[model samples]
Target: MVWKDETKEIYTEEPKEENIFKKEYGNTDDEFTYIEKTKGRDGEVKETVKVSIGKVSRYLLTKFNFKTIFGSKTDKIYFYESGMYIPKGKTKIKTEVEYLLDNKCTTHIVNEIIEKIKRKTEIDEDLFETFSENNLDLIPLKNGVYSIKEEKLLDHSEENLFTFQIPINYNPKSKCELFEKFLDEVLYPEEIEVMKEWFGFHLYRRYFIKKGIILLGEKDTGKTTLLDILIGFIGEKNKTGMALQTIAGGSDFTKLSLKDKHANIHDDLSSKDLSDGGGFKIATGGGHISAEVKFGDYVQFVPFAKQSHATNKIPPNKDVDDMAYYSRWMPFQLDNVILKPNPYLKDEIISKELSGVLNMALEKLKYLLKKNKFSYIKTDEEVKVIMERSGNPLIAFVSDVLEESENGIITKEEMYQVYSEWAKNTENLRLSKEQLGRNLEKNCKFIIAKKGTQKQGRYWNNVNLKGNYSTFLTSKKVIYLQSKDDVSLLQYNKNKSVESDVKEPEETKEEEEKIEQVKIK
Candidate 1:
């Protein structure tokens, strides 16, 4: 073969094959680098071309006479903070783009190339994705922890911190009236506030929210609709659907569902209706939990995103009075449901109100996130009652059978018997005496100490023996036990003074570092 030039210029000496391959492909170019033309089943020629993403990757190795000119010499992918892609890298491509603008390229052509890059950046897979809402490949959500790819939503706007890539959308009207309509669907006031907080959570990742929100009630009361709207804001790919156990569990497959996820939703929890909350607590609480990937070693990461679950029934809880468990829970109730609601309501919200709702939520998050505190309205009475009822039957059982006076005493055995009888009669309320004792110690209502004497070496509530049991209340005051078991607990008793052996739960190093790193100047 002979080498020729475009302007009819020809070389007297023919180019060697090795020199041609080396110069055109590279030193390590594959022997199969030649273009192959084969007819398909339909008799169409199948052309082979090598594609290179700026020498960063060359898996396909597609060939083009253009000679990979689309690839930028800059090492970094160029996507501005405002969800727009540029043809060059952040640092190196600027001068080149400037030179092209100053020389042969028109301003319009440069902008057109930018738009093309936005549509198809022709970058490596590690650099960009094919436009999935909040796709992880494009947007990195680790605010102060992992390597991040931060982007701005608008020019000169503050950079939005994201752990997952979200698709950018807009409101045609640029207003959120349907969002208010969505909020109106929630009949309760406290639940409305909770939804707002949830909105705040999704719009901003820096708040480091501690609690997770779950909607407890029958369907059609707007739980599904509210969650669907939130999902719309995050984009479909960034959101995942997994049972609570799957998310909180150590299983490699379940843990994989969480990788680069914006939300892990537990929608149909028909089987595991009662949650011991092992994984639930982990997802909402800011801390490190060990997880393993497929065929990979175990690694630890701070749980990202607020976990949201919806159930027609209350999920049972094992950790009673646990600050770690309770503090991480943001429970709400949706009453007076309208089952079989408008099926198209979710679509309407997504198309019309999602952007506005996001706008409203961001506005609210700017204020709520200022202190990095979740100071939202407490759960309503219905929400509280539902949480208590669903949490542990023993909570109510102990309060009902056991008295709290100085002289009044209910042994662990007695309380256990009462709980057992109650559990047997109820559907999902059975627990052993040993289990009862454990839960009792965790209860924040009353004291559990050695019954009046050591011979009775067992658990007892309201054990008032002069000053014998007084030492147990070392740091906290001993509220005079009430005689009436029916008295609604007005004040929550503090935890048993920290035992030297019992280690307090500490925040993860990631969260601690993030707090320090993101501190406002």
Candidate 2:
């Protein structure tokens, strides 16, 4: 076809078919190229274009910077943008490719380019985990990114595919008086310090200090507000809102929700007992998590989020005496209640004082980095109180029923019998006798030793029931045991030795034998 440039006062001819295809799309000579169309999709004359396979692949692979992660049942592609890489759905990418080609390429053609780009840009899945924790990719803020080792901002690079970002720009001198008032009114001085340090820990890639936080308080208390501040401080996109029950439930689907989240928030947490704490321990204890995407590949990554929970009632724990389990929790109970709550006050603080809060958290993080550990130390009494409030049945049982004395002694059988009865009467969950023995030794500091030659059993020394089980069994009369055959009640003589009664009737003897051989059902 011949075309004339009337405005230029010259006559020119359109390039031949083979010549046009040979011409590069831009000044650079690249494998991928594009060409203009003389007719529109409706067969009308118009200015439109269609892209080649190489052209579309190059555009997507360069413009969006898509990285393909393989080595799983299914291939996955993540596009880098906004200081992070986001998982892009295949269906969406196909649509985008079709648009660039003016819907000229078949589904097969589009798929071919997509797969070509992915294979050419394929990266080992392990690189995601390694690069995420690299010092240079530690913290990606809205204005700039930071390294965990320094406060200076590093130059932005596409190689750093950070998935999490602090929404606000870093302003070391930012201040908000309203946020200060809210914190002072809600948390004690020590609690505020702990809160700041905990928040600071969320901005990093690796968890140097692994501990979950729980805020205990009643309704209208500032517990939720305090945690909500953390949610705003780290932006909603960086947080995963899931309950402790779900996180510790051992469901891979639930576990997948924690990947790359800055915080796992459980606001208004339910009062469910934590039946399994293994998942919770791994989440806050810096162990790698293997979570599978539903109908997709399994992703293994170390969790970077800090868990924070706000609850009206502390949840019960199955592993209450497991020090390894309980040690991961840091509790702060909110005592102040905002009787007249301003609903918009939280929003106001986030909008005005969020940057200041970030700065405060940064200072706390710096302090922790200098010390190489968390500095907020809880008093012994505070620790005890927190343990007790966490629905620890042993603590309550020990306080209300047991006593410690230098000369006190009780057999394991007798102690278990008393504990079982006490648990039944108090409607508490009864632990196994063997577990009770371990708890006694670990918590009460009581010595466990084999009984004397008289019987084959073990006895707990220096710990006994405050009230004798004899009275607990019955209020009828004093009963004494002599030579393993004794009535239900127990009695000790002046020398604390067993002795028989003066008269031994046949029926009384039979009753004593039955009591001695009685079985617990």
Candidate 3:
């Protein structure tokens, strides 16, 4: 009934929800839901509950000094692009705010979100850090089912399909069968263990293992197959498809591309590919390499993703002579190949077998984390091949010609002759007198020009197992060639041509042509 004195026009308007905030803030009872957990010492347990004041997101935003204006008309959160609060209305708001958040979309909201993110972060912060860190490479947890972005890996944790696509039916047995089958064909039986050790290295990368891998193989040697499985497990976006040279000789754009990669492969390279200058010294964290955004401040981070190079021909031995750099390079030889390319092999492994292999790798990662130190099992065959192809004939020559001098001393002249002969015989580049002197001094603390008490132009003194260039290779100070058989290190080097053993070291187009002609003849 309408009152005659009062003009009652039918009026409908939006309901006022101001009291919703008052209930959570001003009211105490019947507001908060209390959840409790017990914490005690000495076999005792206690329980406690907290009555929180407001919505977690809003409370956190204010707590972190991130003041966002609630858009009345749009029903969205708005924060200035400059990470500030003006407390002004939406109409005629200054240009400081990049734009208003649209309820229609979460896209292009990164700037607003970034304004809200506090410098101090906890577990969830790490999850959000994928954008800022540019470090998206996923590491497997001890539980065999956790992402590296997670700060905590609980015992009750389970594998996540979205993170690195670790499969549902991961069979370790099947993985072993596939890996064994693959490696058995590509490498010697003894060296398979080394290959296994290196394969598992990618999983426990948070340990900051600086080691990279060199996979040397002919076509169809299962190297690409292994990489295919890796790419399947790790989504393409989380890796670099760019060439190694692009990464090595970096620009602002190239540095940006280095982000988010797990295994950055420099596929199918030859010695000439890295001939002008090389990347290992910087890419392996040998030096502090700086990267930056275009027209932005420069920043540097230790790269976690391993830099792998897959090639048919081996890199020059001398180029890899620095033990500090070379020691981190794990080289595997895959000489044998499938004569007929079975395109389905990749499908079988990635679709059917890879998940199992991933689980197997996770198991190894668990063990590695528990061990806490690198106890990589070194295979004799792997060691032999790694040294021979390392581009420095000195290591091979030492293994062949040099004996453990009783006095632990040797003349520079004596050593030079050994290297010279090895160079001529192996058809490798020879170090000049100055370069040789520098290398001896840099690696072994042996000064070539400095003379000893005896009649000598240069002397290597204080030579011991622990204080030499090849000391890190094996436990023994004596070279393996000390044995009576005295087999040449050439047997370990696969790609070396016996007939054209005296080829020149210059990595020019003309030089490559000359070598090809010799091989043809």
Candidate 4:
């Protein structure tokens, strides 16, 4: 059978053989390809087509149909013919370009296609949704691509979905706020000033200041209460352990090893079993400790031993290695103070405020860490206040007196009074005078003693034996005197000695009167 073109009556023949496979070829001179159709065994004709010239096969199809099909007005087309019995039939054809870019469609239709392509090929819808909900502006690109402009997203003037600036007072009702409030209300102005100064110093220096603050006092002193408030303010992340039971064995030295999720709060440390020696250590380099652990048949030694009675004991005298470990920490003792909770705020409210403060501090700490700042110096006054607040009465008194008095100058009477009172109040104040004197010499550079005098014939003099007393008193000089009368000539014979001594010693009355008158004149 043959088919003729509608306009030109150009004919193409169909193949007669049942197994005939006709290959359609397009223009060899142009840059487009065409389709071919064949009748299959099921009495249905299957058609296949190509229109775009990407590879060489498609390029050859364009060359055949030069003027009519491959001309400027249209792309190339191919025709397949066979001289057989089957009839040639009309076929429906489509091209890739027409389906992809339908210019006749509206922008909404194009957008639908774009969205479908994005879902099928490129951008993740979940991420897009998240960004969108967060107020992020994301643009989809060709091939289902999405992009973000860094500058636009980071612009502070407009609120963006992904960006938020936490306000300083955002959580005013947080636990940290309560802590700050408590501190402000409870501490004296001077104490607050010192604490503020300390905070500033640490903040500016970017230091990891670990203060081993111990709160000591009687049961009613609010030690535990204060700690609870402090812990709440500092937040859970900042708190590592609450009343830690033990340190784990073979722990890393770079991080804290205490068990529990809160910071240590030994409510009544004095009442605790400290005989094992477990307590706070500060100012330790690396801020950690290592110990060996042995287990099972292999007895693999772990580096850090956790809290255990065996590990807490004071090392033996000859155990230099253990002593070195113990020397790395500074311990502070605290005395508890009684405080009544404010009736206005509920416990939950106070707790929330404290937590907020702690979180803020942690955030600040993280910021400081990024900047690589750590370590700070305390002013003398601040140091004194801290020492006093820690609850060592001796340290407190010393710090207080040091702040008030002139440097290196304490009156002897004042010293005596302070010492006498301290001795009377303090238990185990058994130091001998000599030991006390030595201690004074070492720490104070002064001598302590009672008054005494030395006698020389008719002269008695007070002796100042203070170690540096002579250095200050230069005018007083020591003098030595001897008797003028010689004892060797006084006695003579045994029998006549008494009479002879009497006769020589006697003075005439007139001589005595003349001596008296001369003495009076």
Residue 51 error for model 2, in Å?
5.2
Per-residue lDDT of model 4, residues 1-521, tens digit only: 55432133434566356634444444433334355565443345655554332432233233221111222232222222221111111110123223433453345433433333223223221332244334322311111111233311122221122111111222323445445544443333234333322222221211243333333233333344445554443333333442322331123332233311123333443222222222333221223233232221111111111111111112222222243333332222222122233344436544355336533444454444454432323343444344232333334323322222222233343443444433443322434544543444333212233333332112111212223221211110000001111111112342243233324223334433442342232
lDDT of 3 by residue, 223-305 (tens): 78767666665545556655555655557556655543455766776554343234555555534446774555454544545
Question: Candidate 3 regions off by >4 Å?
Answer: 1-127, 130-176, 205-207, 242-244, 273-282, 286-289, 294-298, 317-320, 371-521
lDDT of 4: 0.31
Clash-forming residue pairs, model 3: 316-391, 317-390, 317-391, 317-392, 318-391, 318-392
Whole-model lDDT for model 2 versus the true structure? 0.67
Off by over 4 Å in 4: 1-177, 188-211, 215-222, 232-262, 271-284, 287-346, 349-351, 370-445, 448-451, 454-521
Candidate 1 residue-wise lDDT, 1-521, digit = tens: 54543334566776554333221223224332334444332334445543222231121122110011132332234434333333234232334444433443455544444333334434343222223234322332212111123323322212432324445453323677756655654535435555675775665432177667777655456777777777877767767787765664447556656654567666645534434566766666655567664455454655565677887665655454455566666776555344235677778777766656655665566556565656555644434444666555655444333446665465666555545544543334577677767776665366656645676657565632222221221211111112111211111221222122122224333333332332221
Q: How well does candidate 3 match the true structure in TM-score terms?
A: 0.47
How accurate locally, in lDDT, is each candidate? Answer: 0.49, 0.67, 0.46, 0.31
Off by over 4 Å in 2: 1-51, 89-92, 95-99, 103-106, 379-381, 390-521
TM-score of 2: 0.65
Error of 3 at 502 (Å): 29
Ranking by lDDT: 2, 1, 3, 4
Residue-level lDDT of model 2, residues 7-35, one tens digit each, is 23333566444433221233223234444
RMSD each, Å: 18.2, 15.8, 17.4, 31.5
